[model samples]
Target: MTRRNRSGSIGFIVDDLNPMLRGWFNYFKHAYRTEYREIDGFIRRRLRAILLRHNKRKGLGITLDAHCQWTNAYFAELGLFTMHEARVLACRPR
Candidate 1:
């Protein structure tokens, strides 16, 4: 996904990512909590990088702004599926 088209809109990127994230999470639902957290962070960081590159911005101010603004909930709002959330749901008693 690192090579994902930076020209695409964030919504388009999220739409492309959700299915892959869901499938991978389903397969590794039983993995350790820390592992899920780690992977989740990695994915979010990569997405942030994509966002930063898409915006064509540089310097710490923009980077910090992006990190602060484009948070987990923001991504969730954009329909980005999170592995940590999926794990919690999978482990929940129904």
Candidate 2:
């Protein structure tokens, strides 16, 4: 499906990197270990939960290559992942 993104570009600053690594690493750890396995629901439900606290203007999907890289850096600065990445990760095949 087509996803929406916010206008303008996003960037990263040095101060926010640590928290971003912590948060994303925490998320990756839980996800890799199948922490959400017992929860019976749509992927969107879990995806939404993961992304609910993040910025919504960055679009979603694997097609977002450069955008995703910029977003990762930007959110890393902001100490969060772009909501779009959550959607992409959720939609990704196991």
Best by lDDT: 1
Checking candidate 1 for backbone clashes, the offending pairs are none
Q: How many clashing pairs does model 1 include?
A: 0
Worst 10 residues of 1 by lDDT: 55-64
Candidate 2 lDDT at 10 equals: 24
Q: Write the per-residue lDDT of candidate 2 for residues 37-90, one digit (tens) a residue.
A: 322122233233234323443544423443444444444454543434454586
Model 1, 1-94: lDDT tens per residue? Answer: 7453366888888798889888888787766566888888777777887777787766443366777978888887888788888777877899
> Candidate 1 has what TM-score?
0.82
Q: Candidate 2: lDDT over CA atoms? A: 0.38
Residue 57 lDDT (model 1): 62
Q: After aligning candidate 1 to the native by TM-score, how far in Å is the CA of 21 from where it should be?
A: 0.8
| Regions more than 4 Å wrong, model 1 | 59-62
| Top TM-score prediction, candidate number | 1
Q: Which ten residues in a row have the lowest lDDT in candidate 2?
A: 1-10
